[model samples]
Target: MNFKSLKTLAVNGKQVIVRVDFNVPIKDGRVIDPSRIQAALPTINFLCEQKCRIILLTHLGKPKATHDPACSLQPVFEYLAAILPGVKFAPIVPGTAEAITRSQEVRPGDILLFDNLRFHTGESENDLDFAKNLAALGEIYINEAFSVCHRKAASVSTLPTLLPSAAGFQLQKEVEFLQKIMEKPQRPFIGIIGGAKISTKLPVIRALLEKVDYLLLGGALANTILKAQGIAVGKSLIEESMVSEVKDLNLVTNKLRVPIDVVMAPSVEPDALSQTVAVANVPDEQRILDIGPETLELYKMILQTAKTVVWNGPMGYFELPQFEQGTKQLAEIIAGLNAETVAGGGETLEAINQLKLNDKFTFLSTGGGAMLAFLEGKPLPGLEPLTIE
Candidate 1:
């Protein structure tokens, strides 16, 4: 909350480097989703209004500190050019003299986008020398990539220290909404957590368990919890290593709600025969694919009285039509609520977008791991240097 805001900075006519999250899904050299890119428009437009030479720095999919053509930002640049005419692409390697030269050539009111930052060796390593070289590209740094705030990558954490830094509109908005959920959510706050693994979400789950009035569990994650409590999960996905850790969380709390019934199937195939069964009656040959109608009804009843709701992940394998009901119905239920609803993570947003209920939520975060880390009360390295010390 103490971070400097982009609007408060004196950035007139300056070459400003804006770290944005344009890491949208790309297939066959075309962007599949432009939501992440769209989320950053407000910040980019504000810099344009100031006549700043806007230089964009971002990473696509992980290139593992090596140059990968598949991870190139060319497709993204093409997509951006169509929306904002005259936006230039600096195809040169980052942290190089050529890159710096391209930066210097950018005129005020022009936007220049660099290739993948991860294409450089020092990017993921958080090398200060790399950051110093990058700093020469601009006079100020504005972080608009809230989704990458949890990382300690060079562009995220180190480069900010080399220049006057501030949080962009999108980052500021993300922080404000998440902070409200963590600090002082309205009473009757309900949190719904689902997904495939407990390993990644345990911290957030533990944190929410202490804060939320009710915490609902579903998906493969619930399977692990159910198995830990001596219930038969059959061949369902369960993290054996995490069962002990889950048991230590003391599942006796009235706030924690696990599924009582689930839809089971032999496999996730489209033609797999499936049926709804009580949690205790899961067949030895079957796996839980989605929450059953009884469980959905139970969750709906609890959500009705919520004053605030935070959801991450989906209730089931919603990619298939048959298994999509639980997640679809959950979205409809939450959207119909009058409460403040906040949802995040890739799968969760995909489900919401599929249901066409995006505008219904109070906020849909672009972050997945970053949102979880923020909600877990963990300090994000990328955010630390941006703080007003």
Candidate 2:
């Protein structure tokens, strides 16, 4: 918690390099969701008011150090121009002479949008010389990409040390919310966790066991848990390897809540077939794609009186229309609940949007990996540099 606030520093006429997470979903060369961009605006607007020459740095989809035109941030610049009127933005790819020249063109109140930093391998590698080259572009570094803070990328972890660094408003807010849920959430606190694998969410599940009154499992993660408990989950996605680990948790504590029934199908196609059945009755060749009505009602009942709730991952194979019911129903439940509910992760965000329930929650996070890391008390390489300690 020792990180300096963006407000504590003088930004007047100084060049400020803001590392923002603009890895938004795009389709046909257009940004489909502008929420991530909108999240960074408060920090950007504050910098604008301070009359600082701004340089916006971010990565799109991973290119793994290879330059791919498909992963360009050009659409983002276009989206920004539409939102922030009167702001001049010059787009340039960093690690080039042209980028340096473009940086010179940025005046007070103007921004230089650096293209996908992943185009150069140094970004992912956290190369020192690359960090120095990036630091040369500005006098101050503001780590605004809380979504990517768990990584040790050049701009995220390295540049912060090479320049005067601080957390942006979005990062600060994310940290506060993480603390709110993990450190001081009100009871009866409940957590609804889902997704494709138990391996990824194991630490988070273990962490929640200590704090939440009930830790509900769903999706493939639930299937694995069921398998551990010696339940027959037929043709469902279950991690046979993680079953032993899940089994071991039985000895640790008793917060793990499980589903009683699930929606099943022989094939997960759009219109093949589906049926809601008890967990003990899953057919041999059928897959458990969604939670059954009984399980859905069970969740609603538990969430009805929750004083605080944190949910990550979708409740089922929410991408397929046939299996989206559980996740959507959970979203609706969280939306209507009179509780301090915080929901996040990529699939969970998609579920919230698909159900059009964004504003209904108390907080929506931009970070996925970073959120889990913070909740599990793991070291976040990017945020560590800014920590006052």
Q: For model 2, how does the per-residue alpha-carbon lDDT over 201-277 read when each residue is reduced to its tens digit? A: 89988887877898888988889888887778888998889988888666345467777899889877878688899
lDDT of 1 by residue, 189-232 (tens): 99999999999999999999889999999889988889888899
Q: TM-score for all predictions?
A: 0.96, 0.95
C-alpha lDDT values of all predictions: 0.91, 0.86
In candidate 2, stretches whose alpha carbon ends up further than 4 angstroms from where it belongs are 86-92, 251-254
Question: Model 1, stretches more than 4 Å misplaced?
Answer: none
Task: Compare the candidates by lDDT and give the number of the best one.
Answer: 1
TM-score of 2: 0.95
Pairs with backbone N, CA or C atoms under 3 Å apart (clashes), candidate 1: none
